[model samples]
Target: MFREQLARDAARIQNQFDLVLGGLDDLDVTQAMAYTTQGGKRLRGFLVLESARLHDVAEDQAIWPATGIEALHAYSLVHDDLPCMDDDDLRRGKPTIHMKWDQATAVLAGDALQTLAFELCTRPEVGVAEVRAGLALTLAQASGAQGMVLGQALDIAAESAAEPLNLDEITRLQAGKTGALIEWSACAGARLAQADTTPLRQYAQALGLAFQIADDILDVEGDAQKAGKRLQKDADAGKATFVSLLGLDAAKLRAADLIEQGCAALETYGSRADTLKEAARFVIARDS
Candidate 1:
């Protein structure tokens, strides 16, 4: 059910993205923007739709923000793969934006994508004026200096520091880098429905941390081909990840515990949230 729903959501969001991005300039930067946004798990978008459904929101009303979050995620990936950043050449089994185009074009594409995310969020189809405004504002908060950018800055600083980060520090960094967006995506339905966000917020907090822990574990055990990007980067860079700090077995155990807690957090929704429960388990089970 999880796999089926994920695939369906991904396809639906992609079509929405295509429409949202239609009639842009014919330049390479815009082209690169489209290219960089294609082919990924679209997990954040899936969370948006699923959470909205859990709140009894219609799919049509939910898809705008789903597409918006995906654009924001894609922008982050584009910049993360830059020559000065992680400097990777591959993403989602294709050449990254900077590698496929010039660095300037890549930068422009990423900037354009970020702005497009805000534009999508403000679309009438997302919800009422209040929901649209809230989505845009929260997206800025999640992606700005205090959130994802802060995490990325810390990660870059860690590379130059004499000592690797400890578990607690890494956890803080991962919460900003990964958990914030996941939290926003998970809580969006509540924001849309004007329902209480506490339960889903709790679920996402655990799930986000587990997802990062699983990424660290997969770096040690995953196939590079299947993972669709470079693996073992932290090990090669002498960075401290969950797997490095706690050992692979311990990291796996920790991730399992997190998934359990995440599932348990959804108990308030009963069977309606079973798919979300499966998503928590799948976070640990997936290779990519």
Candidate 2:
């Protein structure tokens, strides 16, 4: 049931993307934006929708931010796969944007998608002006210098640093790299309703960390075909990851513990939050 709901939500958000992007000029950059956003778990969007459901926000109103988060995520992935970054040739079981098009097109597509995210977030359907402004503000913070970019910069620095990052350093790094957007997505519903976001914030913090740990585990032991991208890059690069810093078994244990903590944080919502708890489990269990 959880997986089914995830698929349904993914379809919904993808449709939203189609509606928005379909109207744009059919340039290569626009094409790349659509292509890059085409497939994924759509986990971040799911968080927005699920949290909105828990808060009794209508799906019509909730979907704007849901789609917004996904656009932002797609932008990040496109940039991350560029020649200057991870330099990956594949993503989501297909060629990266830079491979399909050119580096310039990929860069432009990423930039356009980043701006489109804010446009979607600020749409009048989302809420009152304050809610829209708040969503946009938090998104900028989550994806900008203080958040994912900072994490990426840290990662690049670590690769050339004299020493490999320790577990604590990696934890802080992943909190920004992976956790920031997840936290924002989970809390968006509360922000929409102007409700306190402490519980969802806690839930996403744990879930995001667990998600990164699971990614490290997948990097160590996962099929590249199933993962839809290159795996074991961290190991090849000699970079420190959860699976490298701690043994694989220990890293798995840590992820499980984090999942438990994430689920526990949703106890205030009882059965309404079961899907999110299942999502936390899926994060570790998924191959991609």
Candidate 3:
């Protein structure tokens, strides 16, 4: 049910983005924008919307701001797939921006998208300047050197190390690499609604961890066609993962436990949190 809702929301947002991109010139730029914006779970946007709804913010009030988060996410994916990072050739069952076009085009496109993300945040339709400022700060902190970039550096560093990682080290790496942006998505929504952020932050932290645990499991057991990316890459890279640290069964159990904790963190919001609660379950249960 949550996945269906997310898909619907994604489709709506994709249409909006298409409309926004219609005026762009350069073919490479247009291609890169359209390619990266294609099919995603849109979980980040959903988090933003659901977090806003928890505070009684209307959907219309949430959409434009949520689009900002989604734009940032797409920008990250483009850069992450570049030759310097994962060097991934494919994403979401489609050619990566770098692969579809060229590295130069990909780099510039990613740069443009990053700026566009901030533009969306500061748009006149995005409500007050104070809220926009808070959201933009959250996004920068999550996406920049202090957060996801640092995490990616750790991941790269771990790959070159001869020694295996301990659980704490792995946790630190994943928290920055994957968890930070996920946390930002939820936090941004809470900020937009001017809601108390303590519980939202806690829930996002747990959700991010659970999401990574599930990703680790999927790396080992997921179908390549469904996942839209290379499977068993973690094992091949000898990268430390939850399943590598703990056995697959234990990792699965840990994911479930984290999801429960995530749900518990939002208990005060009651049914307003149903989408987020279901999203937690979906993260672990997803085949892709």
Candidate 4:
């Protein structure tokens, strides 16, 4: 049931994105934007919509920020796969933006998508003026120097440092790079409805960290074909990941525990959050 709903939400969000980008000119950069945003888990957008549903917010309004998060996430990936960054040649089993187009086009597409994300967040249809402002403001903070960017910068720095990041350091880095946007997505409903976000925030904190740990586990054992990207990059680069630091058995145990904590955090929402619980469990068990 959860998988079916998640697929539905992913399709709906993609349509929302196509609607937004449909009017764009035939520039290669715009084409790249459309391409880069096409596939992936769409888990972040799902969190936005699901949390909004939990708060009784209408789907019409929730779709704005839901699409917004996905755009921002796409922008990050386009840049992350650039020559100056991870220098990856593939994403989702296809050539990356820079590979399909030029690096300049990739940069422009990523920049355009990033700005588009904030524009979507500020759409008046989302809510009242204050709510719109809050969404834009928080999105910037979550994806900016203090959040995801910080984590990215730390990751690059760690590559040339004397030693790889230890457990605490890697955890802190992932918190900013990966966890911040997730935290935002989970709390988006509370923000939209102006409800207390403590419970959702707790759920995201646990889920986000566990998500990264699961990614590390997948890196070690997942099929590259199933993952749709390169696997064992961490092992190849000698980077310290949850799997590297804790060993496979211990990392699996930690991720399972975090998933438990994430689900338990939603106890107050009862069956309304069963999908979220499933999502948490899926984080650890997914092949990709």
Candidate 5:
């Protein structure tokens, strides 16, 4: 059930991307934006749609934020893959933006995509002016210096730090780097409906940590081809990860526990949240 819904949502999101990008000029940066945003689990966008469904929000209204998040996520990846960042050459089984184009084009494309997220959020289809403003404000917080950027800065600093980051520090960092966006995606439906977001927030806290832990596990054991990116980069860089701190077995156990906790948080919605529970399980069980 979850897989089917996920696939359907992925297609829907991609179509929306095509529609959005089709209006842009045929420039290198625009083309790069189109290219980079293509293909992925689309999990964030799916969370937006699903959470919207749970809240009885209309899909038409929810899709704007769903598309917006994907655009923002793509921008992050494009920048992250630049020579000055993670320096990767591959993403989603394709060459990284910087590798495919150049650093300048990649930078511009990422910049454009980032702004595009705000544009989508503020579109009339999303909601009233207040809701749009709220979405944009929260999104800025989630993706900016206070959240994802702060986490990225800490990660870069850790590369040269005298001591490796302890478990708590890593946890704190991941909460910003990864969990912030996931939390935003999960909570977007409630924001759209102007409903309470406590349940989804709690659920996403566990889910995001588990997702990162699962990524750590994958870096150790996952297929690079399936993951569509370089694996074991952390190990090569001597970075600490959940697998490194907790050991592989313990890491897996912790991820399982997190999934359980995430699922438990959705008990208020009962069967309406089964797909989200399945998503929590899939996060750990997935190889990529």
Candidate 6:
């Protein structure tokens, strides 16, 4: 039942994204856009919609806000696949945006998507003016120089450094790189629903940490075919990861603990938060 619901929700968001992209026609831009947006589990958008539902917001009413989060996620994926970053050629079982098109086109496509995310958030039909503005600001801060960008910088630096970081340093790196966006997704959902943010923020924090830990676990054990990119990239790059620093079993245990905390954070919301709780479970259990 949960998987079916998730699939339906994903289709709805994909349709919304298609509608949003209908206004653009430049071949290169559209190609780059399609390459990045075409696939993925759409977990971030699901969180947005589900969190909103938990707070009594209708799914239709939440579509634009959810799309905004997905756009930011797509933008990040495009840049992360660039030669300067992960140097990945494949994503979602197909060529990455940078690989499908020229690097410059991919860069511009990412930039456009990032800007479009804010545009979608600020659209009058989707949210109130203040909510839109606040969501836009939150996304920018999460994706900007002080957040994900800074994390990427540290990751690149760590890859080249003579001394490798220990577990604490690696956790900090993953928190910024992966955790920032996950936190943003949850926070954006709660904000859009007009829910009290204190507990939501706590849930987002724990969920983000759990998500990264699971990602690291997948990197260690998942097949490249399933992952849609090279497995063990962290090991190849000599970057510190949870599995690399704490070992596989310990990392798995930590992920479980984080997921528990994440679900616990939402306890005050009761069964209305079942979707978010299930989402936290999915984060740890996902193979991709």
TM-score of 3: 0.96
Taking the tens digit of each residue's C-alpha lDDT, what string does model 2 give over 32-138?
A: 98898898999999999999999999999999999999999999999999998999999989999899899999999999999999999999999999999999999
Name model 6 segments beyond 4 Å from true.
none
Return the TM-score for each candidate structure: 0.98, 0.99, 0.96, 0.99, 0.99, 0.96
Candidate 5, 1-288: lDDT as tens digits: 899999999999999999999998899999999999889999999999999999999999999999999999999998899999889998988999888889999999999999999999999999999989999999999999999999999899899999999999999899989999999999999999999999999999999999999999999999999998999999999999999999999999999998898899999999999999999899899977
**Candidate 1 residue lDDT tens string, 136-235:** 9988998899889998989988989999999999998999999999999999898889899999999999999999999999999999999999998989
Candidate with more favorable, higher lDDT: 1 or 6? 1
Model 4 accuracy (lDDT, Cα):
0.94
Better of 5 and 6 by TM-score: 5
Task: For candidate 4, write residues 1-288 as lDDT tens digits.
Answer: 679878998999999989999989989998999998898999999999999999999999999999999999999999999999888898999999899899999999999999999999999899999899999999999999999999999999999999889999999999999999999999999999999999999999999999999999999999999988999998999999999899999999999999999999999999999999998999889998
Worst 10 residues of 3 by lDDT: 56-65
Residues forming the 10-long window of minimal summed lDDT in candidate 2? 30-39
C-alpha root-mean-square deviation, candidate 1: 0.8
Which ranges in model 3 have alpha carbons more than 4 Å from their true place? none
Task: Estimate the overall C-alpha local distance difference test score of candidate 6.
Answer: 0.82
Which scores higher on lDDT, 2 or 6? Answer: 2
User: In model 1, which range of ten residues has the least summed lDDT?
Assistant: 17-26
Clashing residue pairs, backbone N/CA/C < 3 A, model 6: none
